[model samples]
Target: MSDNQQPAKNHVTLLLLSVMLLGAALVFAVAADAPHTLVLTAAGLGLSFSRRTPLSRTTRSYVYAGVSVLAATVLQDQIFPVDTQRFYLIDGRYYAPAVIFLGIAITFFEQRDTTLTSVISLALIGTMIAGNSGATIVTNPRFPMTNGLLDYFHFFYGCVVAVQMLAMLAVLPHVDRRVRLPAPGRAWRWHRATVFWVSVFGVAGTVVGLRVAAIHYERLADRTFRDLFRVYMRRQSERMIFGYEVDLWRTVPPRTRADKTPVVRALAAQAPGYLRGRAFVRYGRGTWSSSDTGEHLPPTRPGGRYAYSVFRRALAGRTPSATPPPAPRPATIDLLPATAYPLGGLLAPGNAVEFELIADGLNNSNEGALVPREWDVAGGYSLALDDSIRDTAYQGPAEPPTEAERYLDIPGHIKEDVARVANTVFGATPPRPGTQGRLAQLSRFFEAGFTYELGVKFDPAGKDPILQFVEQRRGHCELFAATTVLLLRAQGIPARYVTGFVCGERPPSGTYWVARLEDAHAWTEAYVAEENRWVLVENTPASGFPTTDSASGVVSRAFDRLLVAWQNLLAQVKRGYVAEVIVALFLGLCRGLGRLLTHPLWGPVAVLSLGSAVWWLWQRRRRRRLAAADRLLVPTRTELQKTLGVLEKQARRFGVERQPCNTIRELARRLESAAQGPLRDALLELLREYETLRYQGTPPAVEAVAEFKAKVRRRLAAPG
Candidate 1:
């Protein structure tokens, strides 16, 4: 075929190819979570099938637009679960709109030359890359990254997409040249060797990259967090910018420790949990700060014994570090949700419970929300309690509380009505006086009237409304915890609010779903002396536990097991083992069928028979058409004489023609001598052949005549 004389490929062929690719993309989208694969595949397909343009170009451009939309949807779904201050999905609401614009912009130069096209292509790529990268980094500002590895993955992902785009663009020209149709009877064969090798290498490269990235992407963040922590701790800032705080790890001590009492030492021996942040005391209008007082230590000598029911909220869903069981366990560790603000102070149950707090930065100090775990103090020394700093005072043995200190240090605003309700719930007679009585009363009080619930409708009027709820005898976990802490504190017991998740849910495979936000809770802590330590007392009514089941439970578990099998089957199919086996079976069956269709002897006979059949049909059609045309066609002698007369008339009409005297042969010779001489060559050749055949009475072969007829008909059909 001539360089530009392509086969007649109309819009229909381009449409068919576009549909096939779009169908493939749809299948992928339905089966996989990542839309990028489908999107890039569609883009590649469009580039390959872009020969039938206007139609091909239009199809590709629109499909790209569709891909952009699908990708946006996938991205949106991926980001939906991460609750952050910024909109990570669209990376800013404008991101989707900007992408749409980029898609449209690419269409402007769809028909341009290579250089101009590349310019537009570069612009589109640049806008897409810069906009998306900016959106991600801007929206998720990494002020103090907990993991450096995660950042690296994020950065690498951008680079990979950019590289993939460039690679695809670089190969577009070669791909486009391959899909074009050829001239009649010259069907273009795609180079099987080239297509096969390129495809195999491309797929292998992709598989290797994805496998490597998957193994390492998630862990990068965690590793980086660890590395940066080590670096920040030892290195001084080369240049500190305004408002830039020191890295979180560098600011806090490596090992969190607390006042060392026997109880603290015992708890510490169990395990080293993240020491929840230290307690805060002074409160400014919108902010809360901690007191400068050091850790509290238990007192030595005792006048009156005291007991503290420290209620710790669970960090639901999170795995706990392995720790040994506590000695003389104070009571049941009632799990509460994170938001519940249990009343009465927060103190774990133990005669001399100690706290080892790894200070979480100052921003969240004493917001009364920290994960509370059994303390693991360094030494088996006694602790001295300091009223000013509730966290810790002295490092020694447990002590007794003075009567006035235990029962009369009521904050001025403890509503009398709230105290009355507390009296009604626990009674003036302490339940198991010093420790036992208080525990029993607390248990009895909660069991009688409260129910656990995931969410509590908070009252804006805080304490006053809580007091009213005490009279009502029913409230959510927060209300119960808040009321308990306040009442216990009012009655001379030190108490504080605590936030954490509740009990872990065990599933079949030794896996547990920790407390979720829905399990956020609160409870109370009261001081006692029987065990010579503070005891954690859960008083938030059991009725308040969330009623809904987790998605990771029974139903989901069964579905996931089934899903695993399906995935395995699909994996086999994608890897081609299943398809290859099927193909082999089909080929085995087809072996006999092929013999029937093309046995050595039969194949030659069948081909000859078909060719004879076609030749017969063509001869019949041509003979009929030639007979009709001949009836209309004058004899050659008459046509020559008429042509000579027309030339003579033209000479006479013009009155100047030297050609008027020329014979037919002379006129023909003169026409042949001019630059356009080839115009008469075909006729001359036809005349010579005709003269030889007719004068000699020689019969031309059917095939030769047929081909000659076709050529003559085609030549005569052209417009002059």
Candidate 2:
């Protein structure tokens, strides 16, 4: 080689060495947590090419880089099967090297810059950004997404990736740099042809390897996961944390952010009857969230219980003869909550209810496993599930579905400053003997510094919004919920972000109420038991809502009365159905027995029967008269006045009751003589509204009436 060419060759050699070193670093970092075989192969391939000669310096560098990437990918596939984990770049050994080498090849070898190149580069960058974005920070323990290390890393990595791509473009020649070959004699050309064919074969092999990878991913992605089903005997549930290491599954495209894509809509459709996975009472938004630990047993019997059966809301409506065979009786199903919701998808085991799915019974519907029954399990259940359904399918298998690990991915471009905050919050050590104490510490840390604020515009200006929120502590529930999942996951909890109404209502008239957009809430759920069951904990402050008083302000507290009514009604309804069946059977039996008794062989029985019928009619008429009188009886105005007088007389005994037309302030003043401070204040506001509606001018708003009903329901339902 010419001396001038030697310089270029040396430069390429140095570049190849840099690739090998970087690959080794990533392998070392990732292998400690999740080891991959690809690192060894990548190292060997790069070393092999270090001493080999190619037709030209340019060809040598490009081929060596390509081979290194291909080798690394093969190694990754061998060790970290898609079955075990999702496609996370840093978590898996091969992805980083593959991406890095590809970047190096595009940057160093190809010196041509065209519109196509720019377009391709932009496409890759966009995917990286999309993949790495949507992090949360939880200084306040209110949101872990903001506080977690991985999310910060994701944003940081994404930015790094973008910068690398841009830097590559800047370094590559803006104009075509393709080299031309001089014509040779026929005899010499034959030797050149043989070399060219060998090169082609190598390229073909590389392409085939990539094709095989694509096929493998396709199959893995299509496999259906198992749905967890069982009833827990206690609070502790056992489960395998499937997506703990990867964040890829949490990837939500910008286009799908607004509407209920298959996932969101699936959860929304089951809203009212859906048994919530956990309840976090602390967040500002009014709802139940799954972000912390709860007592294994219901402190009291779980209230607000609703029976859910997935009924097809808008089916294809096949005619009777053509309808599919009753959906195979929901034998085993995987249930997953929408990614948009705050609580992680809940998996239940034991006493599992028989399910009636809303869509075609397929796991791909993203409606996770529907666990039947009302009992709480201490640990998770063990069951085998068929892995044939895609996330799009809504049916088959009662096994805990494998969560996509991509959801845990941290992009390569997040700003460094955000990570600084994570280090401070999460600290160097993993928190605790358990998940709850760590979360409590995190919540307290955030509450001390951050103020919950909504409707603020985020400035992405190369800095991650999560990082900014950590520093500023002002954003909507989306930020809070995301942060909860991120931080908890960082603490080694299998957490998922969720967005949904915290709590809502059905009026006395049984109409479903639409929570205002302001009612949107976010939270997190962590996998606790083997059945993949989850519990909810809250870290929100008291003043997150708009009631006259903070204690009296919660929508759930306001509707506690109605919730009781609903539960009681449900239990009663179940009994009523049994009663109806019993009565029908009893009447049928009586008629049959009477017929047998009056047969021709026993004609005398006819006379007895006629007498019995006469007596029965007489008794029925007498009972009707008594019931008629009872129905017609009504309280007179005097009686109502007497009732009011009695109420006034016994107000103290029945508990505190404010007078009609009394303002909360007035009630407080009157109670000053006998009232305690905070509790008195809360009751004053609650009763103030009640007094006004019962005795003042216009009736309360439907909202107030509903609120009143809920309170009454709770009180009546409370155990003495």
Candidate 3:
């Protein structure tokens, strides 16, 4: 390759590497939600290669800038379709393309003059901020300051600034060095001015265009763009389905084909049967809604007497005299990693008397939901619960109160159909006139008649879902539970729909149960007025419950165990418990060593040994130093004499041999006169330094003596 072409090639290579690194970082960071990051990265590489084409520098900069803006505009329309009402600017998928294309554009212009590049960079930053704002406002009704806008701004700007700075640092050093020439005429200056203004205007136009496109796409560029940007927001309750919509009216469950997706990794001394989650008391057209609006109970302080009293009262029930009921039994529940939402799940059946431990921000409780004030938390807590109460009929008043009215809510349309089914199954005259008998009969009826199947599809425009499930005799756990709840409510037995995970395989460790996504289930919780507490009634057939039998191979089980270990590690990190343990162990070891060393006999022996070792080390280091100094001092004498002899022989060829009676400095002057040039100067300096070091008590520095010797050797070796 030619000399000129090599550096240019290197510059392009470096630029490409930087761009790729930046692109890869972005892709991996957000690719799970936004795959288009890869496409933009590839396009950026293509633009970088085109820099080799025969085009003016100015023209190339403009071309790249224009292409970048066009790419951003196109991507905005493609990723954010007009039909979607909600736009999550925080979603990397929405803003990745714009950032990638603009970054590439900034890199291209970075090789140009400072003023133009700076302007382009500023324009890019402004464009990004404006586009983000426009997209945020269009998709969300809230003002700019709310919902993590400040954090988003800091993050977005930080990324843009970092990428731009990296690109500039990579390319600026390789900019072509222009030869000094006469100043250009006024017309040339004017042409330059015009190009600058044009670039400015072009960037402004692109920014405006991007904002417009993001706010509302006039026409989608292609079907891929349309499909790629299509927004499908899943409700928070559908997390078990892994972001897929779970239409209540649909026959098939949303997430039926199961792989091993862990729902909870728990370790306890005993198996906690089920971890219950959100419950809905109202049912309408196959949908379940919770409308209890229960008062939020403040979390009791951990160790206070008031806290203990509250827990004691809740667990013991209203004691006639407050003679202090016996302490409740405590069970340790460890929530491993992989569990989502630290609070919303039933720890144990009875009232939680006291929490052994809890993660920060998890201090709120509702009727059946225990959640943190904030959404982000990872560890779990052990609690003391009164597990003595069995799931029996309530002995309280049979009359329903205003609070119980919500559980009896069934849609008017399905009321008659559900009541007819209930009467047919349990008999119209109440064989046993209590809630427990009716619940048991209903459960038995559904388990006998309905077949538990994961894959069942119903027509969108068909009969009521409950009616269809009853007639078809086939559905998943959701359908069975929904039907059971509706039937119970229709028969005036207050019931609610409950969602949670059933216990899965017991690991060989035999400590805790592992609950996977497939274990997620829905069941009916009938309110037993007699007991003043809800009782779980399993209406779903046995076939639907998850089992750890040989169907799941060794690999799946191993993966689950690995997940549990990983979660434990994360919990330790968050609580700093691992660090504390390490520190404690280190201190303990130090204390033990100190105690051992303080013994009179061992202490004297140790001191003597340590002193002997220190003395030996000092002697050894002193010997090495003396040896090094001797080598430095002795080598100079022999090497200098040999070098002078070589120089004398070379001088003899010029008939200027040194005399033994003459001083070295005097001899050097004679040699210089014979061979007058750089060779003469080197010989003089070398001889003068040699005389000073040989005679004077003060020896020259090791480096100076070595340098003088090298000069003498070079002069001698030259062609005479």
Best by TM-score: 3
* Backbone clashes in model 3, listed as residue pairs: 337-567, 394-530, 394-531, 395-530, 395-531, 396-530
lDDT of 2 by residue, 120-212 (tens): 453353334223222232131322332444445443443434343433433332334457455578976797777655655555565566657
lDDT against the true structure, each candidate: 0.38, 0.39, 0.54
TM-score of each: 0.32, 0.29, 0.49
Candidates 1 and 3, the one with greater lDDT: 3
**TM-score sort, best first:** 3, 1, 2
Worst 10 residues of 3 by lDDT: 304-313
TM-score between model 2 and native? 0.29
Off by over 4 Å in 3: 1-247, 253-259, 297-330, 337-367, 380-384, 391-403, 430-433, 457-463, 508-512, 530-532, 548-551, 579-720
Query: What RMSD, rounded to one decimal, does every model reach?
Result: 24.5, 40.4, 15.7
List where candidate 2 sits over 4 angstroms from the true fold.
Answer: 1-404, 415-418, 429-437, 460-463, 501-520, 527-537, 545-583, 586-603, 606-608, 611-720
* Candidate 1 per-residue C-alpha lDDT over 602-672 given as tens digits, one digit per residue, 9 for 90 to 100: 87876788789999999998767545544543354334333334334433332323342344454445445
